[model samples]
Target: MTPPPEDLASEDAKIPAPASPDALRDAILSVAAGDADSFAGLYDATSARVHGLVLRVLRDPAQAEEVTQEVYLEVFRRAAGFDPARGSALAWILTLAHRRAVDRVRSSQSQSDRDVAYESRANTQEPDPTGEAALATLEAQRVRTALEQLSERQAEAIRLAYLDGLTQTQVADRLGIPLGTAKTRLRDGLLALRRIVSAPRQRKEE
Candidate 1:
């Protein structure tokens, strides 16, 4: 992973806007043809946008910067496959950044969930089978009711991600939408479900 730059604040103001579409297309073609120097120019022209999109998705400067580097490496390796008729170079680059950032977020969430589950199991006493079954049934019903409160798209994203064990990318692919849209649905759905689940607890405490 690339380390976050020490002078990012100072450099951000100096970074110019992205190159023209024609210029970027030419640069990508040059890079595809083995011109390493063109890769530098392409990075300069689009790195800010790439990093910004990644940061927006990741909300972590260090991780965004690292993933931004990974996106560029992917771009360089796959530049030959870029078709100008399909889309502009910048769009393609940003799409790659978004996918990579989403992947990183999912990977972090999976690890965190695993750690929490492990700790929970370790601290738990021997199960009371009857009591456990009753609690589990109630919890499942509550969750199902909460899920029904979400919009169809939001609920679908949550189901694919949590129940089907699919990544955000997979959810996007399954729904025939972009990865960013899938992420938004999942995030919004989770927030809504959180509110629904906590309402009873708040009422009980009141």
Candidate 2:
């Protein structure tokens, strides 16, 4: 386990605006060797870029800020395994930030899906062939229209996962994205559907 950065030398804690690649690499190495002060320097040098990448992926400034902190903690623990031959230190750090951000988005989306699913199940009605046939047709039409409200990727995700009965893993593979991203798309698509479906009810109430 990496120790906390509290005991680091105050003199070395000050970070430059944007350290050179060589400088960043050296700081990572120092952190790997249990130099907290060097990790602070690395954090200062690359934090904005890390946060920006996370924000682009997540589109939530609050979540991006939280994930940026996680990225730095991960860097402290994993810096020992970094191979400069594989990539630049900045690339490695940004990759971690992106992954963490995606994970958060996926988790949040999955929870939303679950909530929507539970509500749907709770509201399920007993079948009436005469009424059911008409309702099913109407529901199908509503779904088709609602799908149109999604973004292109979200629509594709919904078609692949729900309509085609593919698992999330399968959708991820088909889309060539991480499973987290696939879940996020599906979640957003479902949320859109829920909103579209509810809009009529809201209008009637109003």
Candidate 3:
């Protein structure tokens, strides 16, 4: 056959510096049994690749640092479970790194999805309408005055949910209020908006 592709030869050449599975196994055993230098060497050998994997999944430098630290801690805690006969030590570390990266990505995605839903929910809730041009202008002023009349916590909840496009849950979380309290604040704020808009006309008629 013609010579294999040069790139394939090059790829094979780039394989990690050969690490003897037997030596790795001995190191794991040595570290688990409390040979401090073996454990330190373990950190020296694996940190770069583990950190790369963390940064890929987290896409945040700070989070990558935290996650990498967690990976090393986990390795130290669970090293006794390593079964060297089944595979290479590097393979084990790589597997753990892969799992941790996937977990971090999934968590980030979940939070992102929650934030989007909250935004959509906040955008959909509203108030009332008016009759005259004066009524409309007064309605705008009343809406502001109504909002201003609320308790600080109540006003914040309404602003977050109505003006700023946050979910009730998000408002509650941001304001440190209970979920039931957030709902009650929103309801009360809307009620105040109605009364304020109607009050000027009620007074003029009288």
Candidate 4:
């Protein structure tokens, strides 16, 4: 079934404001540099959605919880592997969550079944994108529209890296492109989206 308009509007509400790239960079640096509290902050910042993605794909809260830990462990273990050039730290962790969830789903069941499950649960829960400040949903829609203007490949790469939980290598593997191609697509895609998001007034003026 198609998502209800309200659901789409609510979906718009969950993406949050642009995380301070500098702050996020600092967090990743902390983790990479061995500060435990910084690592905890990173986990706390992203765990819910990661858990939600897991549960959506697996439909098991217990398994989702386990996967959540696994996702973070991987994040901590692979902190050095994170590529800030591609996107924000949050996007990196989210990509891990999505890809891990995808792996669990695909490893056990048919892709079609997993997609159906993912879609069914998606409309039921809304992601609260606002970290603290109150931003109206209408403004969120405007941002979403701006994001829609990016090249499809760029957008796809971002989704794959961030939402699908694939590494740049895995993205290249899945897309049948070279690692360099995946990296380029991921970077260009995020830059395009960032430009659209950063210049909201420009888009509005247009």
Candidate topping lDDT: 1
lDDT of each: 0.72, 0.70, 0.63, 0.63
Q: Taking the tens digit of each residue's C-alpha lDDT, what string does model 2 give over 47-130?
A: 777766677678877667656655764676578799988777776776677678777888899879978887888966653566
- Estimate the TM-score of every prediction: 0.51, 0.50, 0.48, 0.45
lDDT of 3 by residue, 119-181 (tens): 888866542443655684774565567788777876777677655656656777898979767
Candidate 2 global CA lDDT score: 0.70
Give stretches of model 1 more than 4 Å off. 1-16, 122-206
When superposed on Cα atoms, how far off is each prediction in RMSD? 16.6, 18.1, 23.5, 15.2
Worst 10 residues of 2 by lDDT: 2-11
Q: For residues 1-206, what per-residue lDDT tens digits would candidate 1 score against the true structure?
A: 42233323233444555577799999989877666567767877887878877886788876776677567656765787899898777767777776788889988998799788879788656545678579968966886798998899888987887666566677889999997777567655655665677678679999
Q: Total backbone clashes of model 2?
A: 0
- Give me the overall lDDT of model 4: 0.63
Q: What is the C-alpha lDDT profile of model 4 across 17-114, one tens digit per residue?
A: 33455776777777765565566566656666566656766788756765675687567656767877877676677667767876676666765875
Superposition TM-score, candidate 4 onto the true structure: 0.45
Query: Candidate 2, clashing residue pairs?
Result: none
Sliding window of 10 residues with minimal summed lDDT for model 1: 2-11
Ranking 2 against 4 by lDDT, winner = 2
